[model samples]
Target: MKKILLAVAALALTAGMGMAETVRIGTEGAYPPYNFVNDKGQLDGFEIELGNELCKRAALECTWVKNDWDSIIPNLVSSNYDAIMAGMNISDERKKAIAFSEEYTPPPLSAYAALTPDADIKGAVAAQTSTIQAGYVAETGASLVEFPTGEETIAAVRNGEAEAVFADRDFLAPYVQESNGQLVWVKGQEKVVVGEGIAIGLRKSDTELKAKFDKAIESMKADGSLNKLITKWYGPEALVF
Candidate 1:
């Protein structure tokens, strides 16, 4: 009986070791509240913790690596990473290049207008899509200024270079508040402008990894673990889906 028990333990240990697979996760450390670098130069945020949790649940060794948002998909396609955990939206454009797991966050893509206390910014945003440039051009009748990322778009509004910007509502909320409410959403524009939520980006060919991530995300959602994490950083309303 003792020999049989020892043999079972050794087999279990070997199986566990064989199951250990390192998964390299790529994220844009620039997007705050989702994934970003702290003052201490360490990566931190909602997505970072979520990724680690998924890794744990999936029983995979994990390494989180930061990549520029624009290059994230390319890096994944180039085999630089096994997955992407950045707050990337699941859009038709992106889907052509990469696959997405079940959506993790369902935050809306919405428009934000710069408030001058007295200026009417509505008519400006009523025409364009939920994009800062489109809104800026429509409302201010000025040429749209291109910004590389969400942070830069907010900065443009703060600098008065642009009257407003557009981004995922959750991503823009904290910044708008921190900017002293200089930014406000264009009311009644919700049903008209923005669509649904965001999803995780994955390499196009990584079907197996995609399946594992989808299962992991479903598990997170089912266990109420995702709710706790969102509530910690974004509050209840942020989980639209």
Candidate 2:
């Protein structure tokens, strides 16, 4: 009887461990104003703050794990992380690999041109420089100067290696402010920019968790918590749905 009881206790312990509500979050600490590592090497940004709030509402403990942008999704699939909150846009291609929670944030795609004397991106952001390389092939015949990361792209524009970059408006706004208007934004025309909306990436099978997150997001939205965070981050004009 003693041995059987011990065995039962062990099984219960294992089940409890498996049921713990600990969520591991994956993020690229390189995307500024969204997710970035500070001067002290600590992760702090809009996404980070939002993640903490969502987890709180859902009664889940979160552990942040940093990885490269390229590996963020793959790592989530391999179970290296439970969710991704790296300011990722919900795209059809990514949806094929994993499931996404309802969009918690929305930002626009914007273009940035350098302000340094003699700096020009007319050649860099053209079709020839883009991966598609077909949009402006006949009209402009320009080439884009591609960088490995958003930071690098911005740096290139700042250092005169490139003339401009097209990136998330959230990140671009801060850059313009930091550069003291050295970088200019070409406002995106409605319905023409790439997709926009920030969501949490989860495993394809985690429907339960997704539902929970969606509920929390909806509750936050109804309570105006989400708007409050938006106001805190980008002020009144950024009240996204």
Candidate 3:
């Protein structure tokens, strides 16, 4: 009877281990080179790839959840998801809402792009709602037009609704290059430095999950795999850890 009881206990422990919960990572599937829906209608991009790698290294069973950029943090706090791997910058204001893992990418340059080189960025600037760039525009007393997505901000500039659109330089580079002179960087306007480097966001209470990711990130950085992935997505000129 004693031997049978021990066998039952061992089977219960094995079943419990097999039932480990899946960690759901939330992201905005609109931002390119960071997180985006590809032609196959599946999530693909730098963050998607990196997030998967991090999960693999940490031995976490993870899944991706598409969430709008504006409510990404709020949803995370509401327990809609386990973490956020959307290219979110680390800032004090955001830290008040959620904790961040160590930075995975360096602080990126923010710039203004408009139809003309001399566009008056100081007059009317469009930015994605709830982003650091929008906050900067508001503080600078510019006519800060907010959009729900990065694509809309550029559309505002193209349609003369805004004098310029401010966003991450990497996100803007492809548009400027493909515009065929239709869009250009605002002349005499230096790229702005906003927020700290990009990092994964988690609920303040998810210390164990945060620690797992932090360790994985540190491992990638130590072995230089992190830099290689950054270059693969952002190009050789892209900033690294």
Candidate 4:
């Protein structure tokens, strides 16, 4: 981790930003609550605000970069950005490629929603590419159709491209609630445990950057701001730990 921080620091010096403490934070702006582009054409979401607060607490100047979900990690490794604050789950598979800060939220729930309560999910289910939800459907022997974004997954359901959509419960909840009878969670369906928890993604060598964010997260957790943020964005039913 220390080596990674030095690598980035060296890069910063070479780029003529010598001694600058700026960090570029990457996120998939398509994911709501975690991140999204607001109507004012500005980046806005729980993670965006949270990341800003973390940078403030850590005394690091930060900027936001929007990346596609499927390639978010690759971009990070390529130095397109320094860290990923997207709603990314911490998993052994990903850990091989990058290191993670301690989780900021408890594990998130993934669920299925269909146009009708009885829609046959065994047929075609939509999930974002490279997501655990997609892996779950494929492993269960269901037809797993991948989309690049959560909105596309839901669109696949409404357009008959898929029988159902699988995604984070918090992400799909608003769509289901606003769709009236047009969409509903499968009756009696159990939420799937997609991964361990959501955390910031950093290069394996960026130990200092990771430590900075980890310390900020710990402070937030200790002061109750982390739980407050979770409840504010994910509702009272949101999990905390």
lDDT tens digits, residues 38-77, model 4?
A: 9999999899989999998888899999889999999999
Candidate 2 residue lDDT tens string, 1-241: 9999999999999988766499999988987777899999899888899999998888788889998876778899999989999777777767889999988876444444455434444566522122112232223444656554677777776676655565666666777777776776643321124554778999999999899899989998899888788768776777476
Query: What local distance difference test score does each model get?
Result: 0.70, 0.71, 0.93, 0.91
My TM-score estimates for the predictions, one after another, are 0.79, 0.79, 0.96, 0.90
lDDT of candidate model 2 versus the reference: 0.71
- Model 4 is weakest, by summed lDDT over 10 consecutive residues, at 12-21
Model 2 clash pairs are: 124-144, 129-144
Which has the greatest TM-score?
3
- Candidate 3 weakest ten by summed lDDT: 186-195
- Angstrom error at residue 241, model 3: 2.0
Q: Per-residue lDDT of 9-116 in model 1, one digit per residue for the tens? A: 999999988886899999889777888899999999999999889888877789998887767778988999888887766666666788888888764455455555
Ranking by TM-score: 3, 4, 1, 2
